[model samples]
Target: MNTRLLAVAALSALLLGGCTDTSPGGQAVRARHEHFEELGKAMKEIDGQLKADTPTSATVRVAADKIAELAPRVKTWFPAGSGPQDGKRTDAKAEVWTRNADFGTAATRLEAAAVALKAAVEGGDAAMVRAAVKNVGAACKNCHDAFKTD
Candidate 1:
């Protein structure tokens, strides 16, 4: 009876382990998608403020800070097996993994742009903030053009 119970327990563990999504490709694809969604939301909020005749410094600061926080984390979401070739639904291009150094540089540039935008918002100068926002947008575009699929 005890032998039969042990065998059942072992079988259950093996079955459950197989059911888990332990693949790095699956996990990275999901994480990178969610991260991009969050970054988009923050960027949209900042853009809306920039479009206003009189943008609120406080709101812009908050949104810009969020982008700064998220930007540095962008590289971490694209580990090995996270590309389109992994059979996962990822917009990340194969070049992201192939040319990793370039991708890392792009991510670093984005973080710097975000940080600059945050500083501009704190300075409470709308024109400077606007310029900084444009820089941020350009940094994002550069990365997306190289590493992401439309």
Candidate 2:
């Protein structure tokens, strides 16, 4: 009788643990957060190169290419039901879903800015690179203001 009760308790614990496991939305949140961290790292790499006494064009090019590659996928990161509604810890605000059109426009703006940055790098103009970086920062800020939580 004691052995049977212990087995039943162990089974119940496993079932309860499964119920509390990360939901699909939680997984999405984690994945998107990771991608965004990569994006931030790439942007920071570019910024570091720019701040150097002699900016390495190669470093800037690699970082710019990464941003361009990641920007367009920003929209897919914030799918419906992936926000705080999932009971997951996320910086994404409810406005991301409620004001989705504006979010989309912001995402597009970031993508365009990234593309412009890539083009500027290809042009081999330091001034153009600076300007493009500014545009990318502006696009990120715009989206954060409207769609992200503090």
Candidate 3:
């Protein structure tokens, strides 16, 4: 009876593990997607604060700092094999690899925009914050347009 139970547990573990993505690049794709989602959340938080009648400086600062922290790491998210060609579930376009230079430029632009955003937040000028947010959004859009499927 104990032998049978052990066999069943082993089979169950194998089945469950098979149900998940065990591809070579799957983990990298998932991790990059998660990072992008976090960046999106920070962007939304900034937007929410902007929409508020009296925008919260602390909230903006926190969100802007998050962008600053994440932007520099954006390039590392897409390793060579972590794309659609590797059969990983990702929305990153083929151009990311094919046009690597352009993608790098876009990533650098986002990093610069994020740094500007952090500076703007520190400056505590509403107009500068708004402009920095606009620049950051534009940088994101540029990359998404060139390198993302959706």
Candidate 4:
């Protein structure tokens, strides 16, 4: 029974090991996507708290910093050999990948805006925070408008 169990375990390991693609590039994209989605959700929560007139600077800063950190990873989704644009994402647009340069520029803008937001959060000034949030939101929206389906 022990030998049988050991054989089964070995087979399971072999079968399941490469079954999951934990490739560096693939892993990076998945991680970035997860981080960005989390950033968005966190930001929405922070925005909701802010709208409630609650002191959520710490929360907002956390979300903002997450976004800032994840922003530069946006390009990871577009791998060199990733092929001709996957529009099936529903959230993705054909043009974003088809017009690669434009997409990269937009991604860079997002990273830059996120960096600014990070600075604002670090500044810990309410007015500056608001302005930075606005700027970061604008940058995201601008890219989404052109690249995202909805």
Candidate 5:
């Protein structure tokens, strides 16, 4: 009876573990999706502030800082086997994996732009902030155009 109980318990553990989609591809898909969503929210908040006639510098700085923090982690979010072909609903194109070096460069550009935006915001100059925001947007567009799908 004791041996049977132990065998049943071990089998149950294995089955439960297998049921969870903890595979690298599954984890990467979920993480990258979440990261992009966060980035989108931050960008939207910053854009809203920028569009205001009398934008709040503090709010803009906060949103820009969030983007700066997330930028570097963007590279890590797209691990191997996380593309659309992995039977996932990701918008990431297969070219992201094939042209990984270019993807890394694009991520670096976004990081640099995000850092610049944060610094511009700190300077309390509206014109500088606007220019930095445009740079950041361009960096994002460059990557999305190459590696992402609509």
Candidate 6:
């Protein structure tokens, strides 16, 4: 009877995990997670195209826009001011919570860089694309430097 009850409880949890609470914040975080995945995929595709000299500027623009959309969502994944935590599901360092404002600023700057990248690619301006990509990279590196470990 105890073993059966335990099995039933485990199954229940599996089903429950599929359904988020759907609160505004929950919705937001879900959106952010999905969008971030999309954005990362787009960036890799765009970078590959660029490096290969076969980029479709229009495609790059679309991808960059998608990434821009995800940039603001970066803050939703971490617990702000909650101290560094370690677990199976987090990519964030405790510094994200310890230095919440700085983390937020880094996220915001990434968004701005994405927007710039979108414009640059859409305009088919190589110089602008390079600059924007560099800016975006700097933002990523800065955030990683402050809040992540290998």
Give the per-residue lDDT of model 2 (tens digit) for 36-122: 998899888888888883333898899889999999999999877678775556799988888889999999999999999999999
Candidate 6: stretches off by over 4 Å: 1-35, 79-88
What TM-score, over all chains together, does every model reach? 0.82, 0.83, 0.84, 0.68, 0.82, 0.69
Q: What tens-digit string does per-residue lDDT give for candidate 6 at 13-90?
A: 656632543544344445545665786688787788779774547677777877787787777766432222432223
How does each model score on lDDT?
Answer: 0.83, 0.85, 0.86, 0.69, 0.84, 0.69
- Candidate 3 lDDT by residue in tens digits, 13-65: 66664236655566778788789999999999999999883344798899888
What are the clash counts of all predictions, listed in order? 0, 0, 0, 0, 0, 2
Give me the displacement of residue 93 in model 4, in angstroms: 1.4
How much is 125 displaced in model 3, in angstroms? Answer: 0.4
Candidate 2 clashes between residue pairs 3 or more apart in a chain or in different chains: none
lDDT of 4 by residue, 31-120 (tens): 545666886896786577568764236777778778877788787775642322421222456676688799899989988888887787
What is the per-residue lDDT of model 1 for residues 1-150, given as tens digits with 9 covering 90 to 100?
699999998777666632344687777777777778988998888888777745555677778888999999998998887677765566788999899999999999999999898888888888888899899999999999998889
Better of 1 and 5 by lDDT: 5
User: TM-score of predicted model 1?
Assistant: 0.82
TM-score of 2: 0.83
Tell me, by TM-score, which candidate is best: 3
Q: After superposition, how far is residue 149 of candidate 6 from its true place, in Å?
A: 2.8
The residue pairs found clashing in candidate 4 are none
Off by over 4 Å in 4: 1-33, 54-56, 80-89
| Model 1 misplaced stretches (Cα beyond 4 Å) | 1-22
Report the lDDT tens digits of candidate 5 across residue range 1-150.
699999998777666642454789877787777788888898888889888843446778788889999999999998777676775556889988888999999999999999999888888888888899999999999999999988
Poorly placed runs, candidate 2 (over 4 Å): 1-21, 53-56
